[model samples]
Target: MGLAAASSEHAPVAACGFAEATAVLRRLTADDLERVNETILDRMRSRAPMIPELAGHLLRAGGKRIRPMLTLAAARLFGYRGLEHVKLAAAVELIHGATLLHDDVVDGSALRRGAQTANVIWGNKESVLVGDYIFSRAFELMVSAGDLKVLQILSAASGVIAEGEVLQLSTQNNLDATFEMYLAVIEAKTAALFAAAAEAGAVIAGCSEEDAEALRRYGADLGVAYQLVDDALDYSGAEDALGKRVGDDFREGKMTLPVVLALARAEGEETAFWRRVIAEGRQDADDFDRARAIMRRAGAIEDTIGCARRYAETALASLQDVRGAKDEACLRALADLAAASTRRSN
Candidate 1:
C-alpha cells in the first residue's frame, strides 16, 4: 500500500528487481518524464496561484512513482521511442494522486507518507477541489497527446474506480460478501487503473490489438496482487511497520479478505463474536484481543497470502506472450516485485 524498508539491504536488492527496471526506464525515458513534469508544473501554475501551490505541495512529496514507471517500462519493452508515453505516465500519476486526495477525505484519514493529509491541513472542500483540478489538468495533458484511445481508456478507468469505491462503501460490514464480489470490487477499483496504464503504454508504442490485450491483463493481475498483500499486512505487520495503527481496518468497519475468509471458517463463539461485534461495529472493550485471536486461528492471514500469490503468478504468466526486451525483463521483474510485496513481513 505504501513504501517500506527491509532489515538487510540485500532484501530490497532482492525485492526490487522491478524497481531496477524503473531505473532503466528512467534513463530511457528521462527526457520525456522531465518534459512532462515541467508541463505539469506549468499547467498547475496557470490555475489561481494558491491552488497550484497547495496541489504542488502534495505532488512534491515524492512517492515511488510506480504507475508512471510501469508506463515507461511498457513502452520501452514494446520498443516505443516517443514523447507520448511520458504524458500518459504523468496522467497515470495524476489520476492516482487525485484519488488519494479524495480517499483521505472519504476515509477521514489524517496522515499519508508521514505527512499531514491535504484534507487535514486544508479541509475537505479544498482537498476535493484541488483533486478535481488535478484530474482536469491530467486530461488537458492527455488531450495534448491527441490519442483518442488513451482518452477512452483513462475515462473508463475513472468511472470503474468510482464505482469500486461506492461498492465498497455499500458493502461495509455486510459479512455476506463473497470472494467473487470482493474480486469484482478490487478489479474495478484497483486493477482498472493498472490495466489503463499498461494499455496506454501499448497504445503509445503502436502495438497490435492482441498485444494491447496482454498488457492490460498484466496490469490487472498486478493490481489485484498488490492490494491483497496490502490487506494481509494489516494483520501480519506491526503498527510502526505498517505506518498506521494495527487493526485500523477493524475499527473502520471495513471488511477485508482476512475478515471475510476468517468469518466463513470461524467456529462457535468465534463466529458469534464477529457477527455481533466486528461486523456490527459494536465491540466491547474486551472484544479486540479475542477477535484477533479468532482471526489467527481461522488461518485468515494464510488464505490472504495464498490468494495474493496466485495473482502474482497470474501476472507473471501474462508476460509470456511479450517478446524479451529490456522492458520485458523489467516487466517480469515487476511481476517478481508484486510477488515479493506479498511476501514481505513489513
Candidate 2:
C-alpha cells in the first residue's frame, strides 16, 4: 500500500498516537536516519541520470521510514555502536523502495504518498529496471556490512515477499479466499521484511539468539497489524488522507480481511452482491457504499481493528523481557503505533 499522511481534517484523534509514536522513533533515530538518507542518495547515483532521477523521485517523497527505523532501533536496543547498522538500515529502505516501485506497476496504481508513482512518471519498464537496480544496491549494502547471517535473513525475506506477491495475484478477485489464506498472504508480503529488518539488526548487534528472535517476532506482529489496518482503511479512510481514492481495494477486487470477514457472515442476497461485485468485477459506483454498509452491519471493520489490536498487543508483549528503559519505551511506542494504524481515518 502507498504511504499516506493523516489529513488534519479527516484524521481521528486516536490516529495522533501513531504520529506521536513515529515522532518518538524519529527523534531517537534522527542521527542514524540522516546517515541512512545519505547512504540512500549515494547508492542511487549511476552513470544513467534517469536511474537516480526516477528512484530519487520516490526516495525524496515523504514516508515515516518506519522499517529502517526499526532496524536502527533494534540495533540500538542491543547496545550496538558500530556503523554497520547504518548500511543495513539503508539496505532495508532500498528493499522497501524496490517493492513499492514494483508493486505500483503490478497493482496498476498511479499514486503513492500523495504523489504520482514512479511507474506513472517514468513508465513501467523504467520503474521495473530501476527497481532491479535498487535491489542490486541493497545486496551491495548487505555485502558491505560483512554479515553473512544478516544477508541470509534479508535475502530469504526478499524471496518470501516475491512469493507473497504472487500469492496475492492468485487470490485476487477470488471471493472465496479464506481468512487463513489472507493471513498467509500478508505474513509473506509485509511481515517478512519487518521480521528480517529487526532480526538483522539484532544479528549485527551480536545479541543473544533468543533476544534476536524476540525482536523478529515483534517486527512480524507489527507488520501484520500495519497491513490489516491498511486493508480496513481502504474501505473507511478519507480519500485525501489515504493518498488514493477510498475503496481502491474494492475497485481492484482484492479480497482483503474485511471482505473475507464479511463474506463469512453474508446472507443469500449479501453473498450474491459480493460475488457480483468482487468475484465478477462488476462493481458500480454505489457498490462501494453498499459494501461499506454491509461491512459495517457485519462489524467487519471493527473486527479487523480488533484483530490488529491483538497483534499489536502481541508485539508489545514480545518486548516485555528487553533490557533497557529507553529501548523498551520506544518498542512499546512502536506497538502503540501499530494499534493506532487501525484506528486511523487515513
Candidate 3:
C-alpha cells in the first residue's frame, strides 16, 4: 500500500498520525479544493437574501472538506484535467453541507464547526428550508456536470442518505439495536456519499470500470472508518478538540456503534441504567459520564476503534489495483488518510 496504495507505508499509519495525514492531503490538493470552493460560492447565490446569509454561515465554517476532496483526488488520480471535476466536487460539498443543516435540526444540535449551528441561529424551520435550498443547488451543480452516470451515482447516493437517516430515526432510543443495524446506518448515511464522490470523479475521468470500483470501495471503507471514530469520539473526545459537545449522541439517544456494543455487554443494573437514559430518554446530568465509564469498562470504545482500523486497512487494500494515477503523492496521502482516519479526535 505504498504509492500503489497511496503512501500507505510512506507515512505513519498510527492513530496519532490522522492530523498529519489530513494536513498532507490538504496541502497536496489546496488548488483543486479552492476551485471547488469557488464553484460552491458561485452556485450558492440566490435572489433571496436569507438564502445566501444562512448558506454562507455554514459553508464558510471550517469543515475538513474530505468528501469533496475525495472527488477531486479520484479525478486527479485518473489524470482528469477538465473543470467538470470542480463542479462535481462543489456538488459533493453542497450535499454534505445540506445534510449538516438538516441533521442539526433533527439532532437539536447547538454547535458545529466550533460555532452555533444554523438551526440554533436561524430556527429549525429556516434551517430545514435552507437545507432544501442547498439540496436544490447541489442537484443543479450535478446537472451542470452533464455526466449522466455521475448524476445517477450522486442522486442515488442522496436518496440512500435520506433512507439511512430515516432508518437511524427508527433505531433511536432502542437498547436492542444490533451491530448490523448500526453498520447499515453508517454505511448508507455516511459511506454511500463517499463511494459516490469517488466514483463520480472516476467516471468524469473516463477511467475503466475496475478503477472506478476501486475508488468507490476505497471511499466506502474510509468513510466507515471515519464515522466509527466519530461515534467513538462522542464518548471519549475533548469538546474543544472535537469542535462540539462530547455527549450529544448520548443525550440524543443515538444508537451508534459504541452504544450498541456497550449495551450488549451490560449487566443487570447497567441494562436498567441504559434503559432509563437511552431507551426511555430520561438522562440526568451525570448520565453521559456514567455511560462513558460503562463503555470504557466494557471496552466498547476500544473495540469500535479497532473495527474502524480494520475498515481503514480494507480501504487501503482497495486501492491496490488502481492504475494511471499521475500523482503518486495524492494516492499515497489517500492511503495514509484511510489508515489514520480511524484515530481522529474529531
Candidate 4:
C-alpha cells in the first residue's frame, strides 16, 4: 500500500470533503504544528553531515504530517495546555519518517511524495542507517516528553511496525496469503503508529483511561481504512494524484486485499492468470491493466473501498463516545477527517 486516493466513481464530494476536513485540522493546529516543525528541524542536527542530508531529503519532501496533527488535536481536545505535546507530536512524525525511509529501502522504491526516494539517491545502506538515526532521535524526543505511558505506546508501536514489515515481506508473492494475513500486516505496520500517536497525545493531556482508549481505537480504525484505500489505489489510482507509480504493488507481488479478493473470486483461466502473475511473479507490461480489469470485473476494488468505508465509519464512531471539549468544533473536524479519509486522493 502507498499513496491513497478516492476512485473515480466516487470522486465528487469524497475528495472535497477530505480536503476541507484536513484543512480544518490544519487550521486548528497550525500554531502548534509550526512549533512541531521547528522542533523537528532543530532536533535533527547532528555531527554527521550525511545524517541530515539523507534525512532531510525525505523529511522536506512534503508529507501531510497528519499523524502529528492528530497528536496535537488530541491534546487540545482535552484542554491540556503544555509544551510536552509538541515534543510527542514531533516524535510521532519522526517515527513515521523513519519508517518511510526504511520502507523505501525494503521495498526498493524509487519515488515518494513525488520526488526521488532517498534510498535511490543515497543508497540503501545510507538510507537504512539514517533511518536508525532518526529512530534514535524519536526515542530521544519521547524520553524528553517525560511520560512513561506515552513512551510505552510509541515504543511498542515501533516494534509492532517492524514486525508488520517482516510479516508482509514473508507473505509476498504467496498465493496462499489470506485476507487475515493481509489485515494482520497492515494493522501492525500502519495502524499501530496511528494508534500510538493519538493515544500518546491523549495520555499526555491526562485524559481518562476510557477516553484514551477511544482515541486509540479511533486512530487504529482510521489507519486501517487509510491503508485499504492505499491498496485499492495501487491498481486504480491516477499516477499524478498518487505521487508514485501505480501497479508497483503488483510489480512487487504484494498480497494486498484486492489481490486476495480477486484471487478468491477467480475461476478457470483467471485463476491461472493470478497464479502466473502473482505467485510466479511473471508479469509483462500489459499484465497490470489486465489485473485491474479482472479486479474491476470481480468487484474486488469496489468491495475493498466498501470495506475501507466500514472501518472509517467505525473510526468516526469511536470518537463519538468521548465527551467533547468546550468548543466541540474540533470534534466535528476530527469526525469529518475520519469520514473523508477513505476518499483521499493523495
For each candidate in turn, the TM-score is: 0.86, 0.92, 0.96, 0.94
For model 2, give the 10-residue run with minimal summed lDDT. Answer: 1-10
Ordered from best to worst lDDT, the candidate numbers read: 3, 4, 2, 1
Per-residue C-alpha lDDT of model 4 across residues 223-256, encoded as one tens digit per residue: 9998999999999899988889888899999999
Flag regions of model 2 displaced more than 4 Å.
Answer: 1-16, 323-332, 338-341
RMSD of 1: 5.6
Candidate achieving the largest TM-score: 3
List the candidates ranked by TM-score, beginning with the highest: 3, 4, 2, 1
TM for candidate 2 is 0.92
lDDT score of residue 84 within candidate 1:
84
**Ten contiguous residues minimizing lDDT sum, candidate 1:** 1-10
Choose 1 or 4, whichever is better by TM-score. 4
Distance from true location, Cα of 198 in model 1, Å = 1.1
| lDDT of the candidates, in the order given | 0.74, 0.85, 0.89, 0.88
Top candidate when judged by lDDT against the true structure: 3
**Superposition error at 221 for model 2 (Å):** 0.4
- Residue-level lDDT of model 3, residues 153-266, one tens digit each, is 999999999999999998999887889999999999999999999999888999888889989999999989989999999999999999998999999999999899988899
